[model samples]
Target chain A: MPRSSTYEAVLDASLFTPAQLQPTAVGRLAFQAGTRWMRDHVCSHRTLVHEHRVGFVLWSWQLEYVHPLRFPDADDAVVEVTARIRGPRASQLEVEMTLEGPAGVAVRTRAASVPLRLSGDEALSGVPRPLPDALVAAFHDDEIERTAHRSQVRALRAGFERDGEQLAAAVSEFRVHRHHCEVADQWYWAETLGFAAGAREELVLKYGKAVPGLRRAQAEPIRRVDVTWLRAGQLWDLLQVRTTAHRLGEGLAFVHELGLADDEDGGPYAVVVERI
Target chain B: MIVKVRGVLLRFTDYENEIEVGGNTVRAGLAALTERYPNLGKVLLDRTGEVRPTHLIALNGERLTRSELDREATDDDRVDIVTAVSGG
Candidate 1:
């Protein structure tokens, strides 16, 4: 049988909004659940990375909301999270995860990650490497669904290219500070979600009256989020988040491109699409 | 001049979204603001009393570079103090 793992955590106010869990919080917790699953099912991540000189980098991630996930106002509202490995390939793998409340699953996440060769200094080498056979063997045979990763970002970009009309757009400029960094002084990947939200809010604040269409995003919940990271941003690096609003079905979608504020030729470090 | 406080920094400003302070430059206005809200002073400035680089400034809807903090401003100018989103 394929292995699955469960994690239990007490909810805090910081993790919740009035209607649901904060998207960033969901991303953080979902990643944690997937990591715990990997540690339980395979060798420990520390040993795999430190001893085997292998590291996993997120290539793409998608989250879909099933319900308005909420927790009661209490000191100890515990939520259950479960994750299962899926689509394990030679150099890439995917994890299917769910966050469950009392009623049922509220959010589903599928993230694709690629293994990298850590350099001698423990720096991310950006070089793809094959997964250790023993580690891949730890996964259930049926869970080894070898398939190419489909990027939601590419599809959305293609759609936007065809449409070619932006309802609204704005750019938010800021510097990556120590607070945004990891041990290597590189901005943590999950912080992109927060930057996207801030950029969206700034857009609404600046042009909500001029372009009322963007208000739909301000009032509604994000139904889905797709993210792709192209590179890492280091501390004190000035960056810009370029956000554009678009019509999606009966709702709205926002595309955020984060890149160097001054380096136009460098292109975006990350692209995030949020569907409301 | 009025300095608009945003996001988590609002808690440090007595929940005041907009605050009026006296100054002719961005630095002077910030100085007055910090004097009024001592708690915010600690968070908004570094040991050198310069604005933290993590926070961005917009004067009258135009982005301002760190060197432009000393640029002249009028009493009618609106300064927006936005905390750059970062991981904790």
Candidate 2:
């Protein structure tokens, strides 16, 4: 009755590590599955914006791995993904996703997103907007369950840099390359970090300086990553990625803020939070 | 005399979505479009009065580079503005 969608795919050999195991592959796959679900159910033919000025922004996401996914060279892992909308608020939407394999549940993800209205100048405002009636009715007709963690629905704020002081002094620079901005398969934003050449190296160099033990921690696996798109960059634009690292309980946390190289106060193009 | 709007460019046109211009080249067509919609110019062109680096202009399905904006166009030709959008 409700619009619960399922996606099926096989874990290719290329997705496996040298040990025949997939690390963080489940998370990446689950993210793709969620985007696919949104494209199919929420914004099928219409754009994400309702009245040209109002739209949705991904606020936060959390993925928990229940079991490691292993793709042996002899046998490929069959992956099944199911995603559904859980809570529909005046200005927020909650989604739950489950990833399963032969070993049963491999990962579960919960994501919270916010609806924003553009001001007269066509810039996103902090104020929330009402969800489109059509979208609301779609969820109601499906009888999607109410999210139990609605209490988690807090106003989305820029991470780490709630104040400018936190991000000062840590800067990494990059240039938007053609490969990163190429549109393929109707998806333009291909790379999560927004396609700069040597992105990994730039990130490592910046983060390595901010965090003392980052080089040593490379051997450890990343536990989680959250990305927020504040703005968009075009080709040939010089961008600077500013990073700040904090020491969490047992791991290192990083906040990377991306913006035009010439204008730091103009605002960020995107922000990435990674835990390793 | 027509400039086609595609992808996210439609958002800036208020969805009335059509523009009439008088110019034999892609540059002239965009200049006319921006004259009518100043906001569109802000999004489509950069401070240097050049097409924004992220946006691509195509004449009859043939993409033109920033320098090629001066390429010839006739009233019968179809000029489209293209920009890559995030799937989120």
Highest lDDT: which candidate? 1
- For all predictions, the C-alpha RMSD in Å is 12.2, 10.8
For model 1, what is the C-alpha lDDT against the true structure?
A: 0.74
Return the top candidate by DockQ.
2
Flag regions of model 2 displaced more than 4 Å. Answer: A1-3, A16-28, A35-59, A70-89, A102-104, A113-129, A141-170, A182-190, A193-212, B1-88
What digit string (tens of lDDT, one per residue) describes model 1 on residues A30-69? 7777778777877676776677766676768898988666
lDDT of each: 0.74, 0.56
**Model 2, DockQ value?**
0.06
**True-vs-predicted CA distance for residue A155, candidate 2, Å:** 12
What is the CAPRI rating of model 1's predicted complex? Answer: incorrect
- lDDT per residue, candidate 2, A1-276, as tens digits? 555567566667766654323334544565566556766666642355434444444555555556555565334443443344445454566666776666776556666555544332232222356566666665554444455334221222232334223322356677665554532112123244333213433555666666447654355555555655555565555788776655544655566667778777778767666555
Q: What is the TM-score of chain A alone in each candidate?
A: 0.90, 0.63
